[model samples]
Target: MKGDYNFFSDKKDDPLDAVCPKLSYQQRLWGFLICSGIGWFLEFCAFISFFQGNGKEFAIIFSIGNLVAIMSTLFLSGPKDQCKKMADKSRLISTIIFFSTLIVTLVLAFATDLTFLTLLMTLVQFCAYVWYVLSFIPFGQRMLKKFFSSCCEFE
Candidate 1:
């Protein structure tokens, strides 16, 4: 008789043993929301600090940095096997969009008076940066696990 070489089959029954469990829909949504909220809070703090005349350069750099941090967190939270691929694609695309918007917004802000359009553009930029962070960062994964473990009531 030949010996079995099915390493995966032996471990299949233990659901929790999987490297990444499939999250429920609610878990996924909640995790995304929490991560986005965190990103927004961080950006809001940066904005407030910058408003105190820390310098326009500081504000611009901090905005970019926040975007990068959020994306990094999202990339890290993905399944280990998919992390490299997802991070490379997501980070590259996000960086391009973030910087382009930043430059354009800065130009607009300087070229024109601080009117409604300027405020709108600034808000859009902040929201875009926050969105990238929440979507790409490992923040969603961490939040999901923490929430599911503590608050979920399984029947």
Candidate 2:
């Protein structure tokens, strides 16, 4: 099994090949979900302790949990193939939804008031997160793929 002959390998066999394998979409999605769950739990615990005046412990937990969440989210969103397939309209829509969600979440996180409107916005943010996840699902992926394919057919 010479390295030159192995197209599936990640790197060359100069005794320094990294063992990172390409994950399937399901694997990446599940990994992202699990890490997110763990990260959220750690953040919740940290927030609780922080509110209880345990500043040092809160900082430690908060930093570690956020590190995990950020890293996993960056790395475990599957391959970049789907990104290349996205149409301009789909990309624009996704970007708008993402930024809008971010704005709402930020406001909800820091706002002191707990009005009915705030609660309603929180619910909308939750639904937006669900939709954000759906945008990476196969249906969205296929839509992007088809967008490109149909354009190619016309051209």
Model 1: worst 10 consecutive residues (lDDT sum)? 4-13
For each of the candidates, the C-alpha root-mean-square deviation to the true structure, in angstroms, is: 13.8, 11.1
Q: Where in model 1 is the C-alpha error above 4 Å?
A: 1-87, 139-155
Q: How accurate locally, in lDDT, is each candidate? A: 0.52, 0.53
Per-residue CA lDDT of model 2 for 1-155, tens digit only, reads 45452133344433222222344567667877888888778878977986887544554565456545544563342223223323245555664664475465445445634434444554564455445555656596567668779889953
Q: How high is each candidate's TM-score?
A: 0.37, 0.41
Candidate 2, residue 8: Cα displacement in angstroms equals 11
Least well predicted 10-residue stretch by lDDT in candidate 2: 12-21
Q: Write the per-residue lDDT of candidate 1 for residues 52-82, one digit (tens) a residue.
A: 7543433454455555444433322333433
Each prediction's total of clashing residue pairs, residues at least 3 apart in sequence or on different chains, is 8, 0
